[model samples]
Target: MIKLLSLLALLWVYMAVVGATHTADLSRKSFPKGFLFGTATSAYQVEGMASKGGRGPSIWDEFIKTPGAYFSFFKHLLEDINLMVNLNFDAYRFSISWSRIFPNGTGKVNRKGVAYYNRLINYMLRKGITPYANLNHYDLPLALENKYLGWLSHDVVKDYADYAEFCFKTFGDRVKNWMTFNEPRVVAALGYDNGFFAPGRCSKAYGNCTAGNSATEPYIVTHNLILSHAAAVQRYRQKYQEKQKGRIGILLDFVWYEPLTRSKADNYAAQRARDFHVGWFLHPLVYGEYPKTMQNIVKDRLPKFTKEEVKMVKGSFDLIGINQYTTYYMYDPHTSPPKDLGYQADWNVGFAYERKGVPIGPRTKLYEEDILCVQAYSNWLYNVPWGLHKAIMYIKERYGNPTVILAENGMDDPGNLTMSKALHDTTRINYYKGYLAALKQSVDEGANVVGYFAWSLLDNFEWRIGYTSRFGIVYVDFKTLKRTPKMSAYWFKKILRKNK
Candidate 1:
């Protein structure tokens, strides 16, 4: 519990440095009619009972024994939906764990697992919340990983498509929005290139791991991921989308890369970063090939899609979900190429958080006036709202103005703060204010942006970071599994009010 003095000090910090009146004049009224507002959570992140309910082990299930968000979502289904209804949210974006549906990744269906998702979807519909379901969210079935090395081999592509088809047959009637995969780039890079996440694999030179080729595995994994995504979309379109009338897409994470200076080298370096990041996945989905920068640099190391695969891969989505978070300054490293090459090393660029001495975004303090703060929640997230604008515009101009959704956008707070300090999330409120304003500006300038969903609705297991950071507007007490709305939630409630 926070002492009275600490609470007073926090309140004073907000009122004095970060004025309480900084909430912008923005609301649902500020955007186009039918714009979506929702919060996102992955299955492994929130829906506990990882081993129960006939659910098979995801790679995540076997990797970590430290449980987070282990409270039964199946037991508290109604309470969660009620919370969404009270907040005036339009939708809830959640992933269906692949192993939950098919315990062994293939062969047998888990009836209990199907029932759990059906209950969750039905409750959301009854509460007037639209369901936006993602098929995969970095939670691959352990069975697949053990079978043919998961995404490393081409065999898993057929299995993934089969699983996606099963979900369409079972749940497509109610779930209108479908995403094949969430951040396949992250899956390839962090899981293979750096060995940072679950099913950890990396070359001996890059990280401590039993096995993996940092140079080749990342590319091969990404190739299989793209193939899996396209195959799923193909099956949905050919078999279910016509009857179900639902749109399917893939979610990709993008960070706006600004050149540190006007020098040609730096500008090219920044482009290389963008090409190697989002373009790694999206370029093929749009143009039927990898980015020129990548093809020229990595050459044979980067996989190529055949003539038949090219036809299947191009124009694969009705929409694209871009998860915009922060911005980084890029500069030419101007160093000799290392003999040890990896996915990130292929970019050949240097990342800078600041230019000269001034910071790109202000370093996080207890409070700041101009809404410039960096490293608030995680090391990568900076409070540069303009990054959202630039990211959306880039998608528009480069990708032929495709329908876009600002899918996962939000910052986080420390998990150890007392209830009083945690509840008063002024920094978070300011974050939404600035980003939403930038999103509105993009729409005003003719970007075909459709929806926005926050990074999460509740604090849950955040991959390698675990529960050390809280990214939700609703605070969850880990001990009792009780959820209390933080000030940011109320801020959302106020702006989203029908009268406002």
Candidate 2:
């Protein structure tokens, strides 16, 4: 009886403290009339019934199975689909692992795979949540990756269009928002150029210059990806849009680049970085060609498109989904001739490595120090909330403020589940608060920012980082496959309820 009384007392104090500290009522901030507030996940990350759905192997399947693949430590894959569907997400954004839909990536349709996705989509709809489906999310069929040079081969574009059409025909009526690709830049750079991701191959090292091969492979892959996206958009516009009344767009992941010193050189370098990162994809979709900066920077290193191709690429999206994480500082070259004058020359500029200029929060210097960027389980993710705000503003200013959906954004930490899973996650909470506040500010300033979807709904396979990093608001015990919502989850739920 005494212990129960004490527990009640503590809970009361906790609620009082929370009320005092957090002022933004999520319930009051209900998304713009028809706006969405949900969480997202990917198929390969959460759906572990890899072999059950007649789903042929994806690059992830092969990558994860490799002897010393980064995430091999978590042998807890092959999770049950029933359990995953019930994981308690407001809304879930996942991909249709292409291999699962077309086991061979082309001719035969995998009925079992189709049924599995149908089940998942039906379950979400039944739960009163929307299903934001992506046609591809980094898990290309291994057969395509090997037989065709994946996205490098223009044929894969047609194959992808067919696959996308299949998805629309199958799930278009039920799913309202369809994303053509999750993050094409990451696919091209990580999978093709850096050789860190699956089908890992450095085009420069291989010297496999087939019709589509060159140092320009990343740009070429992007061009084909754009073509594939356009084909899907065009098909949906013709066949499904009126009947389905759904929206279609492609999700592009971007990192904001700022000039380290406001000099012409630094500014030019920063612009170059943005052009390569965001413009490489956006310019093609919006303007019918790649950015002139990228063209000039890469010179002949990028592939050229005919006039007809340009027409096909432009104005192809109903909306643009952007996934932004961090911002970087750019530096100018000291030498006369720009360092390498190669495709990747601009990335040589320095970054905002130290947290000197970052804005501050109420409690800690960790929040203020621009030098102490939040590190992802993967070295690539450096956290900068203001970067997200800057990114949204840039998109609004540069691209005529298209309806922007923040498709993915979150931080990751790898440690035992303890207080870290509970109250101590102020870092994650602060990150969201700061970024959301900035997003809210953008909306107030007339940027057409429509929605924000946290990067993950649960902790699952984090690609190369494997299960080492946990980014989910709900803690998933890999051993038991039990999901316990973290404090952040509770907080976000409150925010959602208030916003609603």
Candidate 3:
């Protein structure tokens, strides 16, 4: 805990110093000509007035309202929505909350919800900025969670198709780019296995060891989510292709996994980790099936698809959205596997966490000397920009050079500083510089990377973390609802202008 605190303190100081002295040579450092630069946000995170939009309660609404929840009674969504639209966002990527549109998750269209997003979308277009929209971002209607198996149920595939069709029909004419889902793995893991985020339910001990639902839920949800994505893609291709001429795909969050040692055991462990993480989604879309290693490891825990289903899922996407953050080191150690055959065993096959070496340079303070460091806000996010480049390269090699759009990537600072105050965020600027350089390298090496969208446009509700961690390029003053563009925002604008 002290180490974490020290890391945060160093980050704050580093940002303060860098923000003061940071200035890029716009002539020397610029993005490729025509590369798109933008910022992203999610619906549940920024759109408040959940009840006003003919929006029925989502699991998030219920989760936040729980007695001891972090965002309970916190109305920061409207503030964020207003700040995002009224601020200096060139291209804004956000999601349409499911329950907000179809109040009960199925049946009727929520006119108020439709009006709210229509207003937001039109507002962005009026500002001369294109709106990149996603259909779902980890928030399911409470009604759906109650009636169906959530993503765990196969029925969700059709229901999700219906929802996607509705959105494409309603907004596709204006919104050119559409994402089917955002980081489904995180949703499945948090909702089912860990029970840390929402719909918290941890499986009880059956015989001797405690089991986690997350282990199996992902396989189940992936099966459904992929089919749902395929169905949506099918609808788009058949119904709206000639009319809208829009592109649709899924946003996959990937992390580069490296073996700790050159030994065969460690190498094999690293391979297993990669297949389990990236291949979980990529395989179904690319190869029409889940990773073979996942099936070999988890055995029956993974869901099987019929031949027809595989055909439906395989080769269905028009593009792939990569959302990478950090890298993880994998090591193999001699140990017994877990007793149960559910989720915990997914990574328990003598696999252990290994830390990677941090680069030593003038920015060493931000770079923890050890492999595994702490994040300012989320425990899972460690500061590692190099991983982003490696992830893009891996996608290129594995998926046959698919046109990739970096959907979400950014740094999170602990300080509750607004954009006006975050001007001194040198650490963040450096972080972006390093990652952007890596991405540029990937493009030069033939990665077919087209655009980059920073993780967020403004600081908003960070799900379970509430609004504690800020990843916005433009800072939001929660109290006054003021939006201020940070130095990074200025730097991004310069990069975008240079590219243009």
Candidate 4:
């Protein structure tokens, strides 16, 4: 039975590759000159030498130790670089695993780990693909977590700065673009408030975890994360950036929250949601403090920065990477406040999928009999292209129109589909067409978006989702660790082709 199944899968894959089509609705010519098109992946997601190369375990490694609960890209650097070059991608944004460099999170440098990244970056440069290196991507070294409970304690700020400094001194020359942390908000909320990610912790009422105070921990973690970012930026500016001529930034995830209705209450609810989401990070970076809504609602629970700290935290980035994917409708929940308190509960708003029996957008397949909005493989991801425009504009109007990168913008399909169906990927192609158009519209209106990177280069591990969600233009055959360009890959090639 196993042999037969393998043979059938190979046959389908061959059919899928041969049947693939190359088509695109938009072109690179639609955007400003020097605007880059690239793909993104994280160290752990793509570099699958989890325990190899003298690397230590990350919190994620320990968190997902259950049998059959892991997957990765198997670290094919040269081949992956060649793939991106062939797709006409101009850049690659990838994370550096913290544990890979300092096995114990600090002190000794792992030579093997350093050599591997040097090779990867060098190869990318040789292939004319710019390297955008992100210092951390949620894979905190387990040693730090065990020692000082990771981001929860203030002690981590200096240690994290040290780690960032090491990376700056080492990789700052060839790698010109640097992002401190990817989605620190997600790190705070999902890892602390909901217990859904590694080093999972939450209030008993919020999620299943052995230890945490969801209401307070998320704020504390966020506060430290922000300080850590600021310290790293400070170090780079003082020590490395001027010499290397590089830029540093942080990656933030934003979900545009539209008012469920035009009523003042709904509008206020939407604003509150926005303040609590992207504003949670950007407000501090751009304005030197948390959003007023968060400060007022969370009150004493939200940590305050010292006067000196504010100076360092403010204006810490050369650019901002917005990892936008979806949007939601928010309205004033007229009911009384909840007895069980947490980061989400503190918002004092309610989420609604539809109003007056009509969804915010068209449905992909009429998801349920009643829910009309189109959705991706992930339940939370909805197909709403306008959200991208709104998200970029929100930063423009509110956050001083600082330079932005559409760091991650792509939808996923279920990973279980047969090879033929997966490679066809008409829906993924449409998703990109709609989104790229929306992004182009924003750029035309002066959003200062210099580049765009699709969510991934291959179907790799998706943290909590494991291997169940496919968010790659290049399909990977997990059975054989094979790489095949999906129709969307050819679509990108055609649109991004410079020779035309």
Candidate 5:
């Protein structure tokens, strides 16, 4: 009880420092007409029935068999969707697991797997919640990786298209909004370069893995991923975009990089990081080639797109999903040119959470209650809401303001915190309030922003860190799988209510 009271007191102080002074005079009406208010969840992060319903394995299935891996979330779809309805959300953005639909990757479709999503999607529309379906979210079918090394090979471009075409033919009638891939940069960098994600492969100089050429594989994999996205977009436009009247796009994660100080070197370094990060993908999609900076730095290692490939790869979307999270200060370290190289090392920049003792934002972590909790459950996600506004404007100015969706945004609370404390998540409430206000500000500034989806509807699983990190507005007791709405959830409900 003493601990509970202390948490409440800390939250009050934290709220005052960050965002409590700003009244949430904004609501769903605050956004543009036809702009949506929703929440997001990926299948792998929430669905646990990895082997059920004739589902085939994805690389994640094998990866989670690791000793510390937490077990699954597919059982609660109906209950979870119902929660969305009760919360007054306008839509739900979720992914279709590739292995679940085509277990062997390409040869045959899983009827049971298709039926499950059919039920979920149908129910979402029936309840007045729009269904925004994303085709892939990092869970590539394991068979594809085994057969042809997945994204590393050009073969993936065709296989991925076939799978996507099947999905369009099957589900496109009802699911009007679609996304091709989610965060392909993370797919290439973390999976191949740093080896933090599944299908982990890296050179010894980069990460722990049995065998991988970190310098080469990341570029090759990203090239193939770009081709895959373009191929899927082409197929959708040719076959289903007209008949079904559906829209397709890809989701890219962006971190706003502010220069640490007034130094020219720091500003240039920050630009370099931005170019290598989002520009790595967006430049190719927009202009049919890599950014000039990337071309000059990466040189021959970055693959060239032939004339036909370039035509297919460029201007390949009806919308862009931007997952903006936190911000960091970047500066050029001016280190000596590397001998043993890798993709990440190419950035040649330093990241600082603080400058001259002023912290970047708040660092709310597992046991740092002694100080103000600015760190979230994930070490990387500091609560810096203003970053969202800067990132959206950058996309507006840099990428032609193509229709954008704020796909994933929110911070996590430490899982070990007591349910009472976790439910009274005033910090999470203020986090959304500040970030959403920033989002609205971007729209007011003439950014072509279409919608905003909270990172999650409920806490399910956090990869690598397992269940230790909880990111849902609705709390889940991992032991019992019971769902409870935190204070943040009710706050969001009020904002999203149609009458408001």
Candidate 6:
């Protein structure tokens, strides 16, 4: 609680400094017509009914519950929809739990699971909230993981496509915007490289994970995820999309990399960070191959796609969803390459929050009282709002400004914050204000960003961090499952109303 108060104070001071320099004009009227403004949540994160209604256990069930425990959200279905209506949000981007849909990985359909999603979708539509359905977040079915090691095996390409096809056939009619996967890079990196996330896999050099070859598994997992994504896109284009008239895409997380100095080494290091982060996925989808920096560094450890896979993966999406939250400064430390190889080490660059004793932005404050969003737990989430501007501009300059969506952008507070303090949420409001101003500036400069969705709609279970982090605009009392909109939620409601 003291930490929360300190963060709130630091954020207030930062906002004052930012406001003095760049007056943010973030009214909804700034966006073009048809620009989507909404919030998001995933099934596993929010929908708690894990065991009932014929739903099978996901890897998260096995990993989080540590032995596959169950939970439920069935009773709150209508009440949640009613809450969305009250918020006056125009859209909602959520995910479908794979284990809930096909409990045993691929053979049989869970009719109860289907009915649950159908009910959720029907009610959202009835309440006039457009649904942007993502096929997968990080919740892989435990059955698949046990059978074929999940994403590491080529077998997953067909299995994932088969699952995606089931979804398209069933819910494509209602979901106009389809995202194949959310943050696959995070899935590969956090899950396989550091073992910080589910399934707990990492090389011994990286973490105390039970079993994983971080050097090799991250690359292998990413290759299969890319394949799975392309296959699903192909299925949609070849079969359902023509009839359904809906757009299909994938969600990627990007953190803008700024050079610590104007020196050539720092510039190159920054490029390498961007290449290893965004280019790891976007490059393949756009140019049919890995970025030159990645290709040169990762070498054979990075999987290569066959001629058929290349053609299928390229131009795989009608639009791309980028989840941007923060930025960092990268510099070449001139360090020797290590014998132990892992995804993070492959970058060959050093990260810094400051240079010459000056912080990158006010958000770089790491003082215990001033630290925001995971504190030093995640130093990368510094409040560099201009980074969003740079990120969108980078996409335009490099990737041809293809249709884009700011799918996820928000910071978290410690979950133990008092209810009154949580409802105030001035820091979160300022986060939206500053970031949206940056986004608006990017759009004004001819960046073809068409939509923006805040990182989340409601506070629920955050993966790994679990209930320890609160990133939602709406507050949920876990003890009673009560919903309370924060000041930011009311802010969005008012601004969104003004534009409409």
Least accurate 10 contiguous residues by lDDT in model 3: 66-75
lDDT of 3 at 387: 71
lDDT by residue for model 1 (1-500), tens: 45656556555544543442254679998889999899898998888888788888888877776533365566667887888789889999999999899989999999999998899999999889999999999999999899888999899999999999999999999998999999999999999998998779998888888999999999999999999999999999999998999999999999999999999999999999999999999899999999999999999998899999999999999999999889999999999667898998889899999988766663345433322222366878877788889989998999999999888998888777677777878778877877888899999999999899987788777888877889989898888889899888988888888754
| Alpha-carbon deviation at 399 in model 2, angstroms | 0.8
- Model 6, backbone clash pairs (residues 3+ apart or across chains), number: 5
- Candidate 5 — which residues are off by over 4 angstroms? 1-16, 19-21, 66-73, 364-374
| Residue 335 C-alpha lDDT in model 6 | 90
* Candidate 4 minimal-lDDT segment of 10 residues: 365-374
lDDT of 4 by residue, 334-382 (tens): 8776888899888889998777986564333322222211346886777
* lDDT for 189 (candidate 2): 75
Give the TM-score comparing model 4 with the true structure, all chains together.
0.92
Q: Indicate the residue-level lDDT of 304 in model 1.
A: 94
Provide the TM-score for each candidate, comma-separated: 0.94, 0.84, 0.85, 0.92, 0.95, 0.94
lDDT of 1: 0.87
Query: Once all C-alphas are superposed, what RMSD does model 3 give against the true structure?
Result: 5.3
Query: Who wins the TM-score comparison?
Result: 5
The Cα error of candidate 5 at residue 77, in Å, is: 2.0
Predicted candidate 2 versus true structure: per-residue lDDT over 1-500, tens digit per residue: 97666556545543433443354644425346656677777777777767655768887777668422222112332232222334333556777889888988999999988887787778667666778899998988888978877888899878998999999999998998999998998887776665667666554444332223225666777778888898889889999999999999999999888887779988988887888888889988887878898766576777777888787778888888888877667776664534323235434455555436552222221221122213344455555566787888998899888988889988776634353333346556756766777677788788898777887767777887777778877777776677666767777766665321
C-alpha local distance difference test of each model: 0.87, 0.71, 0.71, 0.87, 0.86, 0.85
Query: How big is the positional error of residue 471 in model 1, measured in Å on the Cα after superposition?
Result: 0.2
Candidate 6: lDDT over CA atoms?
A: 0.85
Candidate 5 lDDT tens digits, 386-480: 78899999999988999999999998888788898788887777788788888988999999998999988888677767788889999998888
